[model samples]
Target: MKKILYAIIPILAFSIIFLNMFFGHLVFESETQEVINKYSVYVHLLSEWQSESKNIIFDVTNTWYKSDKIRNTNHVFDAESKEYNSNQLHEINGKSYVELKHEFSDCQEEWQPMLYRKAVDTVRHEIEYVQGQQLSTDPSVSVYPDTENENYDNSEQQSKIKNGFVQFFPICTSKDTTSYNFSVKTDNKDLGFDVYFVSSSDQRENFVNSKFDYYTESGCYGQNKQSYSGTCHDIKKDSGLLVIFPDDLKPWTTKVTVNLYENN
Candidate 1:
């Protein structure tokens, strides 16, 4: 009897030790995996934020170029005299070209600092929230504002038209077909204008020269109104141009707002 009891005691002790070690390893592995998944999510969020910041900077730079072009075309200055043509500098909301340029420069200077601060705040908040909650490994699950699901892209530009015509080129970032909504509102709603979306400069010239009887027949999307709101989906290239001219061939000034949305 004594011999049998000693053998059973040893077996029971071994079994207890083995069971404890096995369960401890499983718990440890689960914790490690959880941490890894959380880290992956954090990294993904940071990458996405960085990409968005780059896009913002790119858009701002492009806008600056476009605005500069419009200013040069409308506000012609005598090279020798260093004098701006008073007739060409039309004021909108009492803001002249100089004032607008100054404001734009200020905005450009602040963008980087604002973006950096936002990135830091967003990451810190996310880290705290993640530590208290079970986060999914899916990269799409993010606390930051989802620009894709919301406003894909938006831009506003003000142009003073002295030649009775102006053209704006907007970039299409998406590889696939996307729809762009344009809202052209002017201070003078009674002053009607013509807006055309053409794929090429030749097409624009043809339209401007009245080569076609109808805009649709000319293979261009167009609107004739004092203020227009419409969508254009024929932008198949990396960029598209919007040509605007007053209906009465008179000088006009207006503000244009463009909103880009992608199809699901």
Candidate 2:
């Protein structure tokens, strides 16, 4: 009877050890799979973020290029002649300036004359001073405004008010990256501008109406800037509007570059 009991006790011990080993293996496999699933989700999200960022950059840059081309081809002022070439002043948006002036004359708005005179004078003066010397015939010579000067005249700046030199752009921020960067530069050093990033169209409209009075407590903005570079991280949404407003009534072209990083 004692020998039989000893054999049974050993068999029971062995069985218990075997069961523990099998259960341990199952637990290990489950934990490993969980880790792999998490990793795969991260990789997928990263890929999507990269694709979206590339598309946003391409769209913004393309739009900027088209705008520059249109402005260059359509608007050319001869300061010396003090005239807009009538041939080049073809109907824009299906309405000619000649037609608009005739309509304004008929309406007899009290502000029409002053407004027209200011517009014409501003165009003439800006073109003369901003262009500097006559454009060269050489292909290498650029006709764009020069931005090398680091100093601006305070008197001239004070005399000018912010104008309608505004541009709107769409910006996309990636949740995976959590932030993005931008750089803005103008060819006219005298033409300082403001940059605002807003999460909604309503915010953009508010900014336009308030102009310099508008303020953002949780967004990115650069005010009275000729050239600026910065990063935005407090993004409340995945997409937003980038609004640019010139500080003065000057016709200038600006170049903007946006960047996104995987590790940011």
Candidate 3:
């Protein structure tokens, strides 16, 4: 009886392990398919000052979630059925300007613009900044209207808003590594910064069954104890650390650590 029981114990344990593995794999595969079915490009609005100074106050506040990186981010915006309108920014003098833009991806390459706005949504695969636009000399400060009134437009009673925001297009890739750097040269001293290269992984075998690149940059935007947020797409990496200095201080430096977050 002892010998029989021992033989049966190994068989029973093996059966349990097999069942768990099989079910887990099936569940993962199902999830992956769903994401692909809903893939589409989305327009994500970002303020240059918010990203640079690290003072991004917005969060998951809007009814819809818009992310350029994540799949099925279209829940944030709708060009069809006219679900929501008037997604624009206000100016200082009470005028309104629509800082509209577009994104291009395999998922949303065919989407067209609507009649309500001047520009329709488009796509650009890489992280390319719109050329010829001016970059703020004072990176520590962000320029935006103090109040939010949705109905106002450009007229005598309208607000005085200017085009100060920069438009960036996110590029998706399977590359193993990516990098960006920043530097400042002053009359009194010269200082430089580096965002070292890091690794990326894709653990979602249940979804696309492919790897996504991860990237990181420290102090690339600005320093003033600000906050910012954006979507990371299929890849994963730390947003980074924030640091601030006094106005009188001349020189400061720090390194950004980057690592990839793969699917598990």
- Find the candidate with the highest lDDT and give its number: 2
Between the candidate structures 1 and 2, which one is better when assessed by lDDT?
2
**Ten residues in sequence with the least summed lDDT for candidate 2:** 35-44
Q: What TM-score, computed on C-alpha atoms, does each candidate reach?
A: 0.33, 0.34, 0.17
Summarize candidate 1's per-residue lDDT along 27-95 as a digit string, tens digits. 222211111110000001112121121110001111111112112222332343222111233222222
lDDT score for residue 7 of model 1: 98
Ranking by TM-score: 2, 1, 3
Q: Per-residue alpha-carbon lDDT of model 2 for 22-58, expressed as tens digits? A: 4422222321111110000000112212122111111
lDDT per residue for candidate 3 within 73-120, as digits (tens), equals: 333333552322224463311222233222222233222212111111
lDDT, candidates in the order shown: 0.32, 0.34, 0.24
